[model samples]
Target: MENATPSRTALGVARMRALHQFSPQAGLFRDPYAIAILGEAAPAAQELEQEDERRQRMRLFVASRARFAEDWLAAAVLRGVRQLVVLGAGLDTFSLRNPYRDLSVFEVDHPATQAWKRKCIADSGLAEPAATRFVPVDFERQSLSAELAAAGLQSTAPAFFIWLGVVPYLTKEAILKTLSWIAGVPGSEVVFDYSEPAANRDAAGQAALAFHAARVASVGEPWISFFVPAELAISMGELGFDEIEDIESGDIAARFSEAPKGMTNNSGGGHIIRARRTA
Candidate 1:
Protein backbone atom coordinates (compact mmCIF):
# COMPACT_ATOMS: atom_id res chain seq x y z
CA MET A 1 0.00 0.00 0.00
CA GLU A 2 1.22 3.49 -0.89
CA ASN A 3 1.84 5.33 2.35
CA ALA A 4 -0.18 8.52 2.85
CA THR A 5 2.12 11.46 2.08
CA PRO A 6 3.65 13.01 5.20
CA SER A 7 4.48 16.68 5.68
CA ARG A 8 7.77 17.96 4.29
CA THR A 9 9.24 18.56 7.74
CA ALA A 10 8.83 14.88 8.38
CA LEU A 11 11.03 14.20 5.38
CA GLY A 12 13.41 16.99 6.34
CA VAL A 13 13.72 15.74 9.89
CA ALA A 14 14.29 12.22 8.61
CA ARG A 15 17.02 13.43 6.29
CA MET A 16 18.59 15.55 9.02
CA ARG A 17 18.75 12.56 11.31
CA ALA A 18 20.23 10.50 8.51
CA LEU A 19 22.89 13.12 7.88
CA HIS A 20 23.89 13.40 11.53
CA GLN A 21 24.39 9.70 11.97
CA PHE A 22 26.44 9.52 8.76
CA SER A 23 28.95 12.03 10.10
CA PRO A 24 32.10 10.85 11.84
CA GLN A 25 32.04 13.65 14.38
CA ALA A 26 28.45 12.81 15.24
CA GLY A 27 29.11 11.08 18.53
CA LEU A 28 27.34 9.37 21.44
CA PHE A 29 24.40 8.43 19.14
CA ARG A 30 24.83 5.39 16.95
CA ASP A 31 22.19 4.91 14.29
CA PRO A 32 23.35 2.64 11.46
CA TYR A 33 20.05 3.02 9.60
CA ALA A 34 20.26 6.78 9.67
CA ILE A 35 22.58 7.11 6.68
CA ALA A 36 20.83 4.37 4.74
CA ILE A 37 17.55 6.21 5.14
CA LEU A 38 19.06 9.10 3.18
CA GLY A 39 20.40 6.60 0.63
CA GLU A 40 23.85 7.80 1.67
CA ALA A 41 25.25 4.65 3.16
CA ALA A 42 28.75 5.91 2.36
CA PRO A 43 28.64 9.61 3.12
CA ALA A 44 32.20 10.74 2.44
CA ALA A 45 34.27 10.39 5.59
CA GLN A 46 35.40 13.82 6.70
CA GLU A 47 36.85 15.82 9.56
CA LEU A 48 34.66 18.68 10.78
CA GLU A 49 31.90 18.91 8.19
CA GLN A 50 30.40 22.23 7.32
CA GLU A 51 27.07 22.49 9.10
CA ASP A 52 23.91 24.40 8.30
CA GLU A 53 23.01 26.24 11.50
CA ARG A 54 19.43 25.04 11.41
CA ARG A 55 20.33 21.46 10.58
CA GLN A 56 23.15 21.43 13.11
CA ARG A 57 20.86 22.73 15.79
CA MET A 58 18.20 20.21 14.95
CA ARG A 59 20.69 17.38 14.87
CA LEU A 60 22.04 18.20 18.29
CA PHE A 61 18.61 18.64 19.82
CA VAL A 62 17.31 15.49 18.22
CA ALA A 63 20.43 13.52 19.08
CA SER A 64 20.33 14.44 22.74
CA ARG A 65 16.71 13.40 23.14
CA ALA A 66 17.22 10.27 21.10
CA ARG A 67 19.76 9.29 23.74
CA PHE A 68 17.31 10.14 26.49
CA ALA A 69 14.58 8.07 24.87
CA GLU A 70 16.86 5.09 24.44
CA ASP A 71 17.89 5.30 28.06
CA TRP A 72 14.26 5.49 29.18
CA LEU A 73 13.23 2.63 26.92
CA ALA A 74 15.89 0.44 28.48
CA ALA A 75 14.58 1.24 31.93
CA ALA A 76 11.01 0.54 30.83
CA VAL A 77 11.99 -2.91 29.65
CA LEU A 78 13.80 -3.57 32.88
CA ARG A 79 10.58 -2.62 34.65
CA GLY A 80 8.78 -5.45 32.82
CA VAL A 81 7.15 -3.38 30.07
CA ARG A 82 6.64 -5.36 26.88
CA GLN A 83 4.57 -3.11 24.62
CA LEU A 84 6.17 -0.04 23.05
CA VAL A 85 4.64 2.51 20.69
CA VAL A 86 6.49 5.28 18.90
CA LEU A 87 4.18 7.95 17.52
CA GLY A 88 5.40 9.86 14.46
CA ALA A 89 8.26 7.42 14.40
CA GLY A 90 9.81 9.23 11.36
CA LEU A 91 13.32 7.92 10.65
CA ASP A 92 13.86 6.92 14.24
CA THR A 93 15.49 3.49 14.06
CA PHE A 94 14.94 2.36 17.63
CA SER A 95 12.71 -0.38 16.28
CA LEU A 96 15.61 -1.31 14.03
CA ARG A 97 17.95 -1.09 17.00
CA ASN A 98 15.91 -3.76 18.72
CA PRO A 99 17.05 -2.63 22.16
CA TYR A 100 14.61 -5.07 23.63
CA ARG A 101 14.39 -8.28 21.65
CA ASP A 102 11.57 -9.64 23.76
CA LEU A 103 9.36 -6.55 23.52
CA SER A 104 6.62 -6.05 20.96
CA VAL A 105 7.35 -2.76 19.22
CA PHE A 106 4.98 -0.70 17.08
CA GLU A 107 5.79 2.29 14.92
CA VAL A 108 3.08 4.78 13.97
CA ASP A 109 3.73 7.47 11.40
CA HIS A 110 2.39 9.03 8.22
CA PRO A 111 2.18 6.49 5.42
CA ALA A 112 4.83 8.28 3.39
CA THR A 113 7.35 8.44 6.22
CA GLN A 114 6.79 4.77 6.99
CA ALA A 115 7.03 3.93 3.29
CA TRP A 116 10.31 5.78 2.88
CA LYS A 117 11.68 4.15 6.01
CA ARG A 118 10.55 0.70 4.89
CA LYS A 119 12.15 1.22 1.49
CA CYS A 120 15.34 2.30 3.19
CA ILE A 121 15.19 -0.76 5.37
CA ALA A 122 14.83 -2.92 2.25
CA ASP A 123 17.33 -1.13 0.03
CA SER A 124 20.05 -1.22 2.63
CA GLY A 125 19.35 -4.86 3.35
CA LEU A 126 19.14 -3.87 7.00
CA ALA A 127 17.32 -6.23 9.31
CA GLU A 128 14.03 -5.09 10.84
CA PRO A 129 13.22 -7.10 13.94
CA ALA A 130 10.41 -9.44 12.93
CA ALA A 131 8.70 -8.72 16.20
CA THR A 132 8.17 -5.04 15.45
CA ARG A 133 5.07 -3.82 13.57
CA PHE A 134 4.11 -0.70 11.64
CA VAL A 135 0.83 1.17 11.50
CA PRO A 136 0.43 4.00 9.03
CA VAL A 137 -1.95 6.80 9.89
CA ASP A 138 -2.78 10.25 8.54
CA PHE A 139 -4.10 12.57 11.21
CA GLU A 140 -6.19 14.31 8.56
CA ARG A 141 -7.86 11.07 7.59
CA GLN A 142 -7.38 8.27 10.08
CA SER A 143 -8.00 7.12 13.63
CA LEU A 144 -5.11 6.06 15.90
CA SER A 145 -7.16 3.68 18.07
CA ALA A 146 -8.73 2.08 15.01
CA GLU A 147 -5.38 1.70 13.30
CA LEU A 148 -3.85 0.08 16.40
CA ALA A 149 -6.87 -2.16 16.94
CA ALA A 150 -6.42 -3.46 13.40
CA ALA A 151 -2.84 -4.17 14.41
CA GLY A 152 -4.05 -6.25 17.39
CA LEU A 153 -3.43 -3.78 20.17
CA GLN A 154 -5.29 -4.49 23.38
CA SER A 155 -7.07 -1.25 24.32
CA THR A 156 -6.69 -2.03 28.00
CA ALA A 157 -3.07 -3.10 27.96
CA PRO A 158 -0.45 -1.01 29.69
CA ALA A 159 2.06 0.53 27.29
CA PHE A 160 4.67 3.21 26.82
CA PHE A 161 3.80 5.87 24.26
CA ILE A 162 6.76 7.80 22.80
CA TRP A 163 5.41 10.96 21.23
CA LEU A 164 8.36 12.98 20.06
CA GLY A 165 8.12 15.93 17.72
CA VAL A 166 4.39 15.30 17.29
CA VAL A 167 2.32 17.01 19.95
CA PRO A 168 3.13 20.48 18.66
CA TYR A 169 1.86 19.47 15.24
CA LEU A 170 -1.44 18.17 16.60
CA THR A 171 -4.41 20.27 17.63
CA LYS A 172 -5.16 20.65 21.31
CA GLU A 173 -8.33 18.64 20.92
CA ALA A 174 -6.53 15.93 18.96
CA ILE A 175 -3.75 15.84 21.55
CA LEU A 176 -6.33 15.42 24.25
CA LYS A 177 -8.10 12.76 22.21
CA THR A 178 -4.84 10.80 21.89
CA LEU A 179 -4.13 11.13 25.61
CA SER A 180 -7.64 10.02 26.48
CA TRP A 181 -7.30 7.04 24.21
CA ILE A 182 -3.95 6.18 25.75
CA ALA A 183 -5.47 6.50 29.20
CA GLY A 184 -8.13 4.01 28.20
CA VAL A 185 -5.33 1.57 27.61
CA PRO A 186 -4.72 0.52 31.22
CA GLY A 187 -1.32 1.40 32.74
CA SER A 188 -0.23 3.35 29.65
CA GLU A 189 2.47 5.93 30.26
CA VAL A 190 3.09 8.66 27.68
CA VAL A 191 6.45 10.27 26.97
CA PHE A 192 6.19 13.23 24.61
CA ASP A 193 7.54 16.74 23.98
CA TYR A 194 5.79 20.08 23.58
CA SER A 195 7.15 23.64 23.17
CA GLU A 196 6.81 26.79 25.19
CA PRO A 197 5.26 30.06 23.98
CA ALA A 198 8.56 31.89 24.36
CA ALA A 199 10.25 29.48 22.01
CA ASN A 200 7.56 30.29 19.48
CA ARG A 201 8.35 33.99 19.76
CA ASP A 202 12.14 33.91 20.17
CA ALA A 203 13.93 35.09 17.04
CA ALA A 204 16.21 32.16 16.26
CA GLY A 205 13.79 29.59 17.63
CA GLN A 206 10.93 31.22 15.72
CA ALA A 207 12.85 31.20 12.47
CA ALA A 208 13.93 27.60 12.95
CA LEU A 209 10.41 26.43 13.74
CA ALA A 210 8.88 28.57 10.99
CA PHE A 211 11.24 27.08 8.44
CA HIS A 212 10.00 23.61 9.24
CA ALA A 213 6.39 24.65 9.84
CA ALA A 214 6.11 26.30 6.43
CA ARG A 215 6.85 23.05 4.71
CA VAL A 216 4.48 21.28 7.09
CA ALA A 217 1.74 23.81 6.33
CA SER A 218 2.32 23.58 2.60
CA VAL A 219 1.36 19.93 2.89
CA GLY A 220 -1.90 20.83 4.68
CA GLU A 221 -0.41 19.72 7.98
CA PRO A 222 -0.39 22.98 9.87
CA TRP A 223 0.62 22.77 13.55
CA ILE A 224 -2.65 23.26 15.36
CA SER A 225 -1.03 23.09 18.79
CA PHE A 226 1.62 24.68 21.03
CA PHE A 227 1.65 23.53 24.64
CA VAL A 228 3.24 25.07 27.68
CA PRO A 229 4.82 22.37 29.81
CA ALA A 230 3.32 23.75 33.02
CA GLU A 231 -0.15 24.16 31.57
CA LEU A 232 0.16 20.77 29.95
CA ALA A 233 0.87 19.17 33.33
CA ILE A 234 -2.24 20.73 34.71
CA SER A 235 -4.23 19.68 31.65
CA MET A 236 -2.89 16.14 31.87
CA GLY A 237 -3.81 16.04 35.56
CA GLU A 238 -7.28 17.12 34.60
CA LEU A 239 -7.23 14.44 31.90
CA GLY A 240 -6.74 11.93 34.74
CA PHE A 241 -3.00 11.28 34.80
CA ASP A 242 -2.06 10.27 38.32
CA GLU A 243 1.61 11.04 37.97
CA ILE A 244 3.61 13.28 35.66
CA GLU A 245 7.34 13.85 35.36
CA ASP A 246 8.51 16.54 32.99
CA ILE A 247 11.99 17.25 31.68
CA GLU A 248 12.60 20.61 30.08
CA SER A 249 14.57 20.90 26.85
CA GLY A 250 17.39 22.72 28.55
CA ASP A 251 17.45 20.10 31.23
CA ILE A 252 17.71 17.40 28.60
CA ALA A 253 20.63 19.20 27.06
CA ALA A 254 22.42 19.55 30.36
CA ARG A 255 21.76 15.96 31.28
CA PHE A 256 22.71 14.18 28.09
CA SER A 257 24.82 16.68 26.18
CA GLU A 258 27.67 15.20 24.22
CA ALA A 259 28.73 18.63 22.98
CA PRO A 260 30.70 19.12 26.19
CA LYS A 261 29.72 20.52 29.56
CA GLY A 262 28.33 24.08 29.45
CA MET A 263 28.63 24.44 25.72
CA THR A 264 25.30 26.17 25.66
CA ASN A 265 22.89 25.75 22.73
CA ASN A 266 19.65 27.65 23.13
CA SER A 267 17.47 26.31 20.33
CA GLY A 268 16.14 23.31 22.22
CA GLY A 269 12.47 24.02 22.86
CA GLY A 270 9.85 22.18 24.96
CA HIS A 271 9.75 19.36 27.44
CA ILE A 272 9.35 15.57 27.43
CA ILE A 273 6.85 14.38 29.96
CA ARG A 274 6.21 10.89 31.31
CA ALA A 275 2.65 10.68 32.48
CA ARG A 276 0.90 7.71 34.02
CA ARG A 277 -2.86 7.63 33.76
CA THR A 278 -4.27 7.11 37.25
CA ALA A 279 -7.97 7.29 36.56
Candidate 2:
Protein backbone atom coordinates (compact mmCIF):
# COMPACT_ATOMS: atom_id res chain seq x y z
CA MET A 1 0.00 0.00 0.00
CA GLU A 2 1.81 3.12 -1.18
CA ASN A 3 1.29 6.29 0.84
CA ALA A 4 -0.29 8.16 -2.05
CA THR A 5 -2.02 5.33 -3.90
CA PRO A 6 -4.74 2.82 -3.09
CA SER A 7 -3.64 -0.78 -2.64
CA ARG A 8 -3.31 -2.70 -5.92
CA THR A 9 -4.33 -5.97 -4.27
CA ALA A 10 -7.31 -4.15 -2.85
CA LEU A 11 -8.42 -3.20 -6.35
CA GLY A 12 -7.97 -6.80 -7.51
CA VAL A 13 -10.06 -8.10 -4.60
CA ALA A 14 -12.80 -5.64 -5.45
CA ARG A 15 -12.72 -6.80 -9.07
CA MET A 16 -13.05 -10.44 -7.99
CA ARG A 17 -16.01 -9.51 -5.81
CA ALA A 18 -17.63 -7.67 -8.70
CA LEU A 19 -17.11 -10.70 -10.98
CA HIS A 20 -18.81 -12.91 -8.39
CA GLN A 21 -22.02 -10.98 -8.96
CA PHE A 22 -22.22 -12.43 -12.48
CA SER A 23 -21.33 -15.96 -11.41
CA PRO A 24 -23.86 -18.80 -11.21
CA GLN A 25 -23.02 -19.06 -7.51
CA ALA A 26 -24.15 -15.49 -6.94
CA GLY A 27 -26.84 -17.02 -4.77
CA LEU A 28 -24.12 -18.09 -2.33
CA PHE A 29 -23.67 -14.46 -1.34
CA ARG A 30 -25.83 -11.61 -2.56
CA ASP A 31 -24.06 -8.25 -2.55
CA PRO A 32 -26.21 -5.93 -4.62
CA TYR A 33 -23.77 -3.04 -4.26
CA ALA A 34 -20.60 -4.97 -5.10
CA ILE A 35 -20.68 -4.22 -8.81
CA ALA A 36 -22.24 -0.80 -8.52
CA ILE A 37 -19.59 0.40 -6.09
CA LEU A 38 -16.83 -0.19 -8.62
CA GLY A 39 -18.34 2.26 -11.12
CA GLU A 40 -16.35 2.16 -14.41
CA ALA A 41 -13.69 0.02 -12.74
CA ALA A 42 -15.93 -3.06 -12.73
CA PRO A 43 -14.68 -6.05 -14.67
CA ALA A 44 -15.67 -6.08 -18.33
CA ALA A 45 -17.80 -8.82 -19.92
CA GLN A 46 -14.74 -10.25 -21.63
CA GLU A 47 -12.93 -10.55 -18.30
CA LEU A 48 -15.85 -12.46 -16.86
CA GLU A 49 -16.05 -14.71 -19.93
CA GLN A 50 -12.38 -15.64 -19.74
CA GLU A 51 -12.50 -16.88 -16.14
CA ASP A 52 -10.55 -20.08 -15.40
CA GLU A 53 -10.64 -22.55 -12.53
CA ARG A 54 -8.24 -20.46 -10.43
CA ARG A 55 -10.21 -17.27 -10.99
CA GLN A 56 -13.48 -19.05 -10.22
CA ARG A 57 -12.09 -20.43 -6.97
CA MET A 58 -10.65 -17.07 -5.96
CA ARG A 59 -13.90 -15.30 -6.73
CA LEU A 60 -15.98 -17.71 -4.71
CA PHE A 61 -13.57 -17.71 -1.79
CA VAL A 62 -13.72 -13.91 -1.61
CA ALA A 63 -17.52 -13.97 -1.74
CA SER A 64 -17.78 -16.85 0.75
CA ARG A 65 -15.56 -15.14 3.30
CA ALA A 66 -17.79 -12.06 3.23
CA ARG A 67 -20.88 -14.25 3.51
CA PHE A 68 -19.41 -16.05 6.52
CA ALA A 69 -18.46 -12.78 8.18
CA GLU A 70 -21.82 -11.10 7.62
CA ASP A 71 -23.69 -14.20 8.77
CA TRP A 72 -21.81 -13.99 12.04
CA LEU A 73 -22.47 -10.24 12.13
CA ALA A 74 -26.21 -10.87 11.81
CA ALA A 75 -25.98 -13.28 14.70
CA ALA A 76 -24.09 -10.70 16.72
CA VAL A 77 -26.74 -8.09 16.00
CA LEU A 78 -29.35 -10.47 17.33
CA ARG A 79 -27.28 -10.75 20.47
CA GLY A 80 -27.38 -6.94 20.97
CA VAL A 81 -24.20 -5.76 19.27
CA ARG A 82 -24.78 -2.38 17.61
CA GLN A 83 -21.40 -1.37 16.21
CA LEU A 84 -19.81 -2.85 13.08
CA VAL A 85 -16.16 -2.15 12.26
CA VAL A 86 -14.75 -3.23 8.90
CA LEU A 87 -11.01 -3.49 9.23
CA GLY A 88 -9.05 -2.98 6.01
CA ALA A 89 -12.33 -2.24 4.30
CA GLY A 90 -11.23 -2.29 0.65
CA LEU A 91 -14.31 -1.36 -1.38
CA ASP A 92 -16.54 -3.36 0.98
CA THR A 93 -20.26 -2.59 0.56
CA PHE A 94 -21.66 -3.97 3.82
CA SER A 95 -21.68 -0.41 5.16
CA LEU A 96 -23.89 0.66 2.28
CA ARG A 97 -26.20 -2.34 2.49
CA ASN A 98 -26.49 -2.37 6.25
CA PRO A 99 -29.98 -3.65 7.07
CA TYR A 100 -29.91 -2.85 10.74
CA ARG A 101 -31.02 0.72 11.25
CA ASP A 102 -29.32 1.06 14.59
CA LEU A 103 -25.99 -0.54 13.68
CA SER A 104 -23.19 2.00 13.38
CA VAL A 105 -20.54 1.05 10.80
CA PHE A 106 -16.93 2.21 11.06
CA GLU A 107 -14.77 1.56 8.00
CA VAL A 108 -11.05 1.56 8.82
CA ASP A 109 -8.55 1.63 5.97
CA HIS A 110 -5.52 3.29 4.44
CA PRO A 111 -6.03 7.02 3.78
CA ALA A 112 -5.55 6.80 0.02
CA THR A 113 -7.81 3.77 -0.35
CA GLN A 114 -10.52 5.34 1.76
CA ALA A 115 -10.36 8.52 -0.30
CA TRP A 116 -10.63 6.57 -3.56
CA LYS A 117 -13.55 4.55 -2.20
CA ARG A 118 -15.33 7.71 -1.17
CA LYS A 119 -14.91 9.12 -4.64
CA CYS A 120 -16.14 5.90 -6.22
CA ILE A 121 -19.22 5.87 -4.00
CA ALA A 122 -20.03 9.45 -4.88
CA ASP A 123 -19.39 8.95 -8.58
CA SER A 124 -21.64 5.88 -8.64
CA GLY A 125 -24.48 7.99 -7.19
CA LEU A 126 -24.86 5.72 -4.20
CA ALA A 127 -26.15 7.29 -1.02
CA GLU A 128 -23.62 7.12 1.74
CA PRO A 129 -25.45 5.48 4.61
CA ALA A 130 -25.95 7.66 7.69
CA ALA A 131 -24.55 4.86 9.84
CA THR A 132 -21.19 4.85 8.13
CA ARG A 133 -18.04 6.63 9.33
CA PHE A 134 -14.74 6.37 7.48
CA VAL A 135 -11.54 6.13 9.49
CA PRO A 136 -8.25 6.53 7.65
CA VAL A 137 -5.06 5.11 9.09
CA ASP A 138 -1.82 3.71 7.74
CA PHE A 139 -1.44 0.35 9.48
CA GLU A 140 2.35 0.50 9.45
CA ARG A 141 2.74 4.08 10.64
CA GLN A 142 -0.34 4.81 12.74
CA SER A 143 -2.21 3.28 15.66
CA LEU A 144 -5.48 1.50 14.88
CA SER A 145 -6.72 1.95 18.44
CA ALA A 146 -6.08 5.65 18.35
CA GLU A 147 -7.55 6.16 14.91
CA LEU A 148 -10.65 4.13 15.71
CA ALA A 149 -11.08 5.97 18.97
CA ALA A 150 -10.81 9.32 17.21
CA ALA A 151 -13.42 8.08 14.75
CA GLY A 152 -15.85 7.62 17.69
CA LEU A 153 -15.60 3.86 18.29
CA GLN A 154 -17.05 3.11 21.73
CA SER A 155 -14.41 1.20 23.60
CA THR A 156 -16.95 0.22 26.24
CA ALA A 157 -19.54 -1.16 23.85
CA PRO A 158 -19.28 -4.42 21.99
CA ALA A 159 -18.39 -4.17 18.28
CA PHE A 160 -18.31 -6.76 15.53
CA PHE A 161 -15.22 -6.50 13.27
CA ILE A 162 -14.93 -8.00 9.81
CA TRP A 163 -11.28 -8.09 8.71
CA LEU A 164 -11.06 -9.72 5.30
CA GLY A 165 -8.22 -10.01 2.76
CA VAL A 166 -5.76 -8.46 5.22
CA VAL A 167 -4.21 -10.71 7.81
CA PRO A 168 -1.60 -12.46 5.72
CA TYR A 169 -0.06 -9.17 4.60
CA LEU A 170 0.72 -8.15 8.18
CA THR A 171 3.44 -9.31 10.53
CA LYS A 172 2.62 -11.58 13.50
CA GLU A 173 3.25 -8.78 15.98
CA ALA A 174 0.91 -6.43 14.16
CA ILE A 175 -1.82 -9.09 13.90
CA LEU A 176 -1.68 -9.83 17.61
CA LYS A 177 -1.64 -6.14 18.46
CA THR A 178 -4.90 -5.58 16.62
CA LEU A 179 -6.45 -8.68 18.15
CA SER A 180 -5.38 -7.65 21.60
CA TRP A 181 -7.05 -4.27 21.12
CA ILE A 182 -10.26 -6.01 20.03
CA ALA A 183 -10.08 -8.31 23.03
CA GLY A 184 -10.00 -5.35 25.36
CA VAL A 185 -13.53 -4.49 24.35
CA PRO A 186 -15.92 -6.79 26.16
CA GLY A 187 -18.33 -8.94 24.11
CA SER A 188 -16.58 -7.97 20.88
CA GLU A 189 -16.37 -10.50 18.07
CA VAL A 190 -14.22 -10.47 14.92
CA VAL A 191 -14.08 -12.42 11.64
CA PHE A 192 -10.79 -12.48 9.71
CA ASP A 193 -9.00 -14.66 7.14
CA TYR A 194 -5.48 -16.09 7.22
CA SER A 195 -3.31 -18.56 5.32
CA GLU A 196 -1.40 -21.60 6.51
CA PRO A 197 2.27 -22.05 5.60
CA ALA A 198 2.85 -22.82 1.91
CA ALA A 199 4.29 -26.19 2.86
CA ASN A 200 0.88 -27.24 4.15
CA ARG A 201 -0.64 -26.85 0.69
CA ASP A 202 -0.77 -29.46 -2.09
CA ALA A 203 1.60 -29.05 -5.05
CA ALA A 204 -0.99 -27.42 -7.26
CA GLY A 205 -2.13 -25.27 -4.36
CA GLN A 206 1.47 -24.28 -3.74
CA ALA A 207 1.82 -23.19 -7.35
CA ALA A 208 -1.33 -21.12 -7.21
CA LEU A 209 -0.22 -19.54 -3.93
CA ALA A 210 3.15 -18.74 -5.43
CA PHE A 211 1.57 -17.14 -8.45
CA HIS A 212 -0.76 -14.90 -6.44
CA ALA A 213 1.95 -14.09 -3.88
CA ALA A 214 4.36 -13.02 -6.56
CA ARG A 215 1.71 -10.86 -8.17
CA VAL A 216 0.99 -9.00 -4.92
CA ALA A 217 4.68 -8.75 -4.07
CA SER A 218 5.40 -7.18 -7.42
CA VAL A 219 3.09 -4.39 -6.29
CA GLY A 220 4.99 -4.05 -2.99
CA GLU A 221 2.54 -5.77 -0.64
CA PRO A 222 4.22 -9.12 -0.05
CA TRP A 223 2.63 -11.84 2.07
CA ILE A 224 4.52 -11.87 5.35
CA SER A 225 2.54 -14.02 7.77
CA PHE A 226 1.14 -17.54 7.90
CA PHE A 227 -0.43 -19.19 10.94
CA VAL A 228 -1.24 -22.76 11.87
CA PRO A 229 -4.95 -22.92 12.76
CA ALA A 230 -4.42 -24.64 16.10
CA GLU A 231 -1.67 -22.26 17.08
CA LEU A 232 -3.76 -19.24 16.06
CA ALA A 233 -6.67 -20.48 18.17
CA ILE A 234 -4.38 -20.88 21.12
CA SER A 235 -3.05 -17.37 20.61
CA MET A 236 -6.59 -16.03 20.38
CA GLY A 237 -7.48 -17.80 23.61
CA GLU A 238 -4.53 -16.21 25.32
CA LEU A 239 -5.55 -12.82 23.94
CA GLY A 240 -8.89 -13.15 25.86
CA PHE A 241 -11.15 -14.43 23.09
CA ASP A 242 -13.23 -17.27 24.49
CA GLU A 243 -14.92 -18.58 21.34
CA ILE A 244 -13.22 -19.31 18.00
CA GLU A 245 -14.57 -20.70 14.73
CA ASP A 246 -11.96 -21.53 12.09
CA ILE A 247 -12.96 -22.58 8.56
CA GLU A 248 -10.53 -24.03 6.05
CA SER A 249 -10.56 -23.18 2.34
CA GLY A 250 -11.70 -26.68 1.41
CA ASP A 251 -14.79 -26.39 3.63
CA ILE A 252 -16.07 -23.00 2.39
CA ALA A 253 -17.95 -24.37 -0.60
CA ALA A 254 -19.69 -27.01 1.49
CA ARG A 255 -20.81 -24.35 3.97
CA PHE A 256 -22.53 -22.46 1.16
CA SER A 257 -24.71 -25.04 -0.60
CA GLU A 258 -25.62 -22.81 -3.55
CA ALA A 259 -22.03 -22.67 -4.82
CA PRO A 260 -21.70 -23.49 -8.55
CA LYS A 261 -20.70 -26.96 -9.81
CA GLY A 262 -17.17 -26.08 -10.92
CA MET A 263 -16.42 -24.27 -7.67
CA THR A 264 -14.68 -27.16 -5.99
CA ASN A 265 -12.81 -26.64 -2.73
CA ASN A 266 -9.18 -25.79 -3.33
CA SER A 267 -6.45 -27.73 -1.53
CA GLY A 268 -4.99 -24.32 -0.65
CA GLY A 269 -4.02 -23.40 2.91
CA GLY A 270 -6.36 -20.39 3.24
CA HIS A 271 -8.72 -20.07 6.21
CA ILE A 272 -11.40 -17.77 7.65
CA ILE A 273 -11.76 -17.48 11.40
CA ARG A 274 -14.15 -15.84 13.86
CA ALA A 275 -13.07 -15.11 17.42
CA ARG A 276 -15.19 -13.65 20.24
CA ARG A 277 -14.29 -11.83 23.42
CA THR A 278 -17.04 -12.74 25.86
CA ALA A 279 -15.77 -11.16 29.04
Mind giving the per-residue lDDT tens digits that candidate 2 earns over 1-279? 778999889999999888887777788888888889988889865687798777777777898899999999999999999999999998999988899999999999999999999998999999888889999987777999898899899999999999999999988999999999999988999999998888878888788799778888999999999998889999999999998999987787577787765445566668889999876
Question: In model 1, which regions exceed 4 Å deviation?
Answer: 1-6, 22-25, 41-48, 198-222, 261-267
Top TM-score hit: 2
lDDT of 1 at 256: 54
- Tell me how candidate 2 scores on lDDT: 0.88
Model 2 / residue 25 / CA error / Å: 0.4
The all-Cα superposition gives candidate 2 an RMSD in Å to the true structure of 1.3
Query: What is candidate 1's CA lDDT for residue 155?
Result: 74
